[model samples]
Target: MTRQSISITAPNDHWLKAQVENEEYASKSEVVNDLIRKARAQQDEIEWIRAKLIKAEQSGFTDESPAEILTAFKEEARRNGDL
Candidate 1:
């Protein structure tokens, strides 16, 4: 694995230390990596939503009701592991 030498604020450092003390993570590197993974996943989800919005805009009006649209959106999110 690659080694990093980044610095953080006192509060962030304290939070990382607390995570280690609580045994939530094995080390600061692990915590940072997990956070990065989560952020990347969220970014991917955002991109998916953005693409859907663009396509919807291009497709014009839909006949579906708002409730139906919301339900379909929630179902899709669940299927994508975002819910």
Candidate 2:
């Protein structure tokens, strides 16, 4: 795989190195990779939630009982095998 060099300042570098040591990351690159993956996962979740909300709004969904809403969500999740 191709790699690129990134410059970090002292405190940020120190924090990253400390995290690497404390978390037992194999190297700084591993820590950075994990961070990137975690951030991407978070972004994906946000985007999914936003899309769901927009669809719900567009569908004119009304306020419903928490249990009913949850049941619908669980059914959808199970249908998609994502629960």
Off by over 4 Å in 2: 63-83
Please, what are the lDDT tens digits per residue for candidate 2 over residues 22-68?
97797898888888998998678657756666576567676654455
Clashes of 1: 0
Question: Relative to the true structure, how large is the alpha-carbon lDDT of every model?
Answer: 0.82, 0.76
Query: TM-score of predicted model 2?
Result: 0.68
Q: What is residue 15's positional error in candidate 1, in angstroms?
A: 0.2
On residues 50-79, what C-alpha lDDT tens digit does candidate 1 reach at each position? 676656655777766545655687798899
- Global Cα lDDT for candidate 1: 0.82
* Poorly placed runs, candidate 1 (over 4 Å): 63-83
